[model samples]
Target: MKAKILIVLGLLLLNFGLQAKEKECIKLHVGHNEVPENLIEKKKSITHTHHLSGHEPVHIENHFGDVKVRVWEKPEVKVNIEITANAPSEKKVQAFLEIVKIHSEKVNGEIHFKTDLQCLASAFENNINGGDDKEERNFLRVDYEVWMPEGHDLTVENSHGDVYIPRFLSVLNLHQNYGNLFADHLKNERSVIDLNFGKGFIKSMKGGQLNARQTALLIDKAENVVMTNTSGNVKVLMADHVDMKTSYGSGHIDKVSESCRFQVKYAKEFILGEIMADVDKLEIESSHTNLELPLCVKGRYDLSTNTRNTDLVLKDQPKVHYITTGNDAEKRMLIGTTTETNATKVRVTSSYGRVEVK
Candidate 1:
């Protein structure tokens, strides 16, 4: 019996030891790999400063990295570029760094800065031809930080990265994809933005045009602007003389001071919060939509619906004249008018949806 007990204790100790050893092996396997000296990342920085004549347009193009632009009081354009290359060996990294470059020049009175990665294709082809499997871990990226004078026309194009501009007081032409744009204030004669698969946040815009696809845009205040979106959502807190078009999306306009027009199709919901008394014209056309609008007592509204429901809540305005024609089975027309002499003209048309006016 004593020999049997001793054998059992030995087996239990062995099992515990095996468990501890297995845990240690797993911990070591999950740990991060130590980087070798040859495999360390190589970095390079290039800076260029050009004294501008204050009338030249600055254009920048980048891919696979971020671009940040800020305004300065100096009459010069300064660009700082950071390049990073990583590969399996120091020699491979050096090869990649040799081909990746930034090309900057003055062409037709325009300052142009572009990322030159065309030679990388040849480098990759050479690696494939040589049957090198180490190219799989090779990567190169370039980022830009630019500072320029105010009132200069600036254009930037980027892909797979973010673009940030704090305050731009000039014409801006910004195009981006698979990224986001954050602008504090853009004030100028004209600004155009084209974005896809991204989000845009503009705190204030004086006059601009925005074209977006699969994006969400938020503007705190916009004046004399035109916006078009596809499969996106737009929200504007204060809009003046703005025209907006959205398809397969949604929109919300909190307040309108001058004039506004909205065109929405296949939208989830569209809401217009309020219209000031100074508004001259307000128009809305929608299909397959759910919309909500505020009824103004000093306005003349002409509403038409085709095969849909209309809910007009006029509990507070008893002095208003409201009329309805046609039955619920077909197209219907409703007109509401107040006794105000300089009443604003409001038109709303909808099909196969609901309209709620209060």
Candidate 2:
């Protein structure tokens, strides 16, 4: 009877040990792997590097600096950070560096890199963007250059700085304000890019789902894109399965391979190029703008406009029907569609503007 009780107690202890091992959080400090080295003397620049094991989600946060990421063929992750500042005095610069601390914690295969920036959040209040709200002055900036293995998820949040990633093949989530973003090539399955009052440019990206919101956006190629912008222009060279909304801006879409849905308000111009899908779906809404949608192939279309200067000029001249509603001055809504079975469904609406579809 005593042996049986001892066996049961041993099993219970083993179970608790396993649970504690699974939930262990390892906290690392700087200078463990390499010493903090100063790169530049006059500008007060310093660099640090940390090497990590295993693959997992990584999060990085910076208040004022650039962040660059790249993928390598190794199985480990390496982080390189550089901090630069231009202060009024050397003592102030040293004080700023002392206040900025790098904290890294790894738990359950996830790594988080953070810095203490609460000290400077109340110091630098300056009018930067010609707006009523005062922005924070960047007395010091910490730029990061990280290299990780492929297929690891990453999230970065940076403000008043730039973020650039080249050749990434993982899930990426980025948030940047008052800075620029440039992703050279992205092979991720999913990504979310959010920018406020900044410019964004992407090139040669392949993904199943992508969501981006920027003040100005430019993309070379994309698939399954959802984007929103305000007060800035957008341009895309080639895309598939896109849904976009814009306000007080213009859009120039070059080639669409599948489907597109666009909504614009107070736009200057909206141009849509060729549609090359077998069964495409195009939907557009415009107000106080001019739109041009030139169809390069034959498809079924449903178009409507409340302005008198709208025109539908089809070169092939398929079967069509039309209906007009309301008075000539206040409203002159025209709805038209082509009668065809197994055809692409296209719907468009415009108010106080001209839309030409061909």
Candidate 3:
């Protein structure tokens, strides 16, 4: 009878030991990474290189915080995770890691996690985008610092964290609904950035051949540029081959060396700084705004403008078709200089603003 009791107690202790073994704790050094210049005073970015053992599906998710992940090839696939944090204390970091352990799960294999003395929530503010006026910021703030090899497929999502990467080459798709995301440049094309902003700002690519889309886009001296925006200040300088679209913002294009294309729907005003290129097509819908364009193009162009101001002018005949849609005051504005030969087609439509060829 005593032997049976002893055996039962041993099995119970074994079960508790196995359960504890499944939960592991890790610590990281706090002086390894660089936070932003402004954030360095208030917060810090900590880098960590963690490892995972065996095949376990590792899931790390943060609600309103920054997150970064990297995978590398070392005979066996090692998951090295790096985190930049604005956490306050070592004790808080330990507590936050415990919270992370409760939520972190191993799907592919077992993970040996390592992090810094600060909590992950210290990296960014944890304010949800809308309708969350009653909750406190109990989650951790984590600014992300991720680096992977050439072919790691990763997906990152956040609520109030801005995504910033200095350099990395991996298949990455990211979206930030309420913060400004910035990437200096991609070293190679293996890295793909898919980003969105809610009320914050977004600055994706500076120069070089980049494929970028923004709710409110901004560009300065880009080679091949494509910009779309709702209502934000946009500036373009001496460059070429730009395809642009806007709803209710001003566009300034100057000294473009090649043929450019622009489609503006509802802008309060329009400004063409200097059009020194042969335009392929400058199709504009000036609903209740002003219009301006250069006199010539290399090939064909579809020029259309609707203005309230009746004194409109076109100094040359367009090579393609000149289609006008508006009142008689809009039609009488297409005045030309030459008795006319081969010129790019110019179309005019006026409802409420002036049109000019400058």
- The TM-scores of all predictions, comma-separated, are 0.76, 0.70, 0.51
Ranking by TM-score: 1, 2, 3
Worst 10 residues of 1 by lDDT: 1-10
Candidate 1 TM-score, C-alpha based? 0.76
Output the better candidate (1/2) by TM-score.
1
Candidate 3 wrong stretches, greater than 4 Å: 1-97, 100-139, 151-156, 165-172, 185-216, 221-227, 238-241, 292-351, 354-356
Q: List lDDT for all candidates, in order.
A: 0.71, 0.62, 0.41
Tens-place lDDT per residue, model 1, 144-244, is: 99999886899999876788988888899999987788888888758899989889999988888989999999999988888898999999999898888
lDDT of 3: 0.41
Evaluation by lDDT, superior candidate among 2 and 3:
2
Ranking by lDDT: 1, 2, 3
The residue-level lDDT of candidate 2 at 63 comes to 59
Per-residue lDDT for 1-358 in model 3, tens only? 0000000111122222223334332222222232323222223333343343333323233333445544345423333333333223444333433433222333454322333322334322231132221121112344444444434444455545555544444434455454555554333334333334432222233222322233344444544555555565355654465566665666666555555566565666666665443533334445555656654434323354445644565545453234455554444222232222333334555455556674
Which tens-of-lDDT digit does each residue in 221-336 have in candidate 2? 87676777778888889877777888788889888777778898888898887666463567787888788876545544544444444543444344445545454532222223
C-alpha RMSD (angstroms) for model 2: 15.3
